[model samples]
Target: MSKVALVTGVGRRIGIAAAIAERLGNDGWDIAFNYWQPYDERMPWGRDAESRAELVRRLDRAGVRSLAVEADLEDAGAAEAIFERVGAELGAVGALVLSHAESVDSGLLDTTVESFDRHFAVNTRASWLLIREFGRRFTGEHGSGRVIALTSDHTVGNLPYGASKGALDRITLAAAHELAQLGITANVINPGPVDTGWMGPELIDTMVGLTPLGRLGTPADVANLAGFLCSPEGGWINGQLLYSNGGAK
Candidate 1:
């Protein structure tokens, strides 16, 4: 039977998240892609509605059932809303990619409670809310399910962004243990600086110079890992924080 999956922040460059979405779609899973279209336009590196429309087209062309929902994940019930749509339009969620986040880069002294809370509102809380909601609904009737979130090496820096992810990472790890018998394997992927809109060409070059791969980590690289974690063969690899960072430590 075909599996259903939910992928967040999957429009435009979609980053490694899009690769995960496309890989699952290609592998016979119905995909539910969520994007923060309303907030995307404000960022200098943002991809607007038209840009996301192209992503929908690409996913549709791949011949997989795809639904694109524009939701402000910080809007309280957004995660549940997306799940409702997926459950209504698709069938069941076999996998979930908690890849959505909201933030403005801030240094230690420059950060504020509002900023940290903002990140939590989306990055930290939304993923867990979605996971918890989905867990209540997922019944392992078909097979064990997969839950993966895109974390970042940034967490090591202990900066605000990194702290948020560190918390999110712990959430997945704990959930993995709690859901162990239930057959829901939860894990996280920490990708190094990719050319995703977040980081520019110069930054990518600098990051690549530091990496052993001598190139920026591509969405394909992360996608392949995501596909594995979502595959039947990956049932044993649970509760791990895998670094998919081009050999970057």
Candidate 2:
């Protein structure tokens, strides 16, 4: 069997998760992707169930085996279920791409206990559990294990959202150090201000002006970086937060 990659939050067609899955599929990896339809429905850019089915078709066209898992990461048992399903269906996972997030916007004072917990459950707690499970199931004989997480720098009004992802970054970095002996590389990619249907026209224009590259980031841009980091060439890069945001700083 070919190597497998497990990517989360791939409910939408025009999403970073989908792009990353496609890139890995093209690079000779079968895909086992996870998505929560309800989460996508609650977001600004809504996603339909058909989109998930279509993504599977696209991956099939790319000549790679594909499996779509419908799961909600807010559930505590989600991480284990994801790994188990992928393992049962695709043999073993060689790469894990964490692109799922709860994108609720709220200030420090406005953030409710429920909201904070939800974000933490999905973004922080679930991520660490997924990484832990991957490490446990990883086998060096198949190939080096790759863990790539998508993160952002929005810590202003997005208190819980940003803070939760911050925890994910820290744990991912720690995983890089702890798992290096097993040939597993852990890294976070901060794709700043990506225009994945969330940004309005004015917001996109303002971000474009702020970016040194004079353009907003596309999903493909993030996918390319993820592809490189999961490849053999990226074996030496570990425990680092690499920014792929068109020089936004």
lDDT of 1 by residue, 106-144 (tens): 777778888788888888888889888878788655346
The digit string of per-residue lDDT tens for model 2 on 132-220 reads: 99999987553388999999888899999999999999999999888877789999999998877888899999999989989999999
lDDT (C-alpha) at residue 159 in model 2: 96
- After best superposition, candidate 1 residue 149: deviation in angstroms? 0.6
Worst 10 residues of 1 by lDDT: 152-161
Worst 10 residues of 2 by lDDT: 136-145
Off by over 4 Å in 1: 155-158
Error of 1 at 15 (Å): 2.1
lDDT of each: 0.80, 0.90
- What is the clash count of model 2? 0
RMSD values, in order shown:
1.9, 1.2
Clashing pairs in 1: none
TM-score for candidate 2, please give it: 0.97
Model 2 regions more than 4 Å off: none
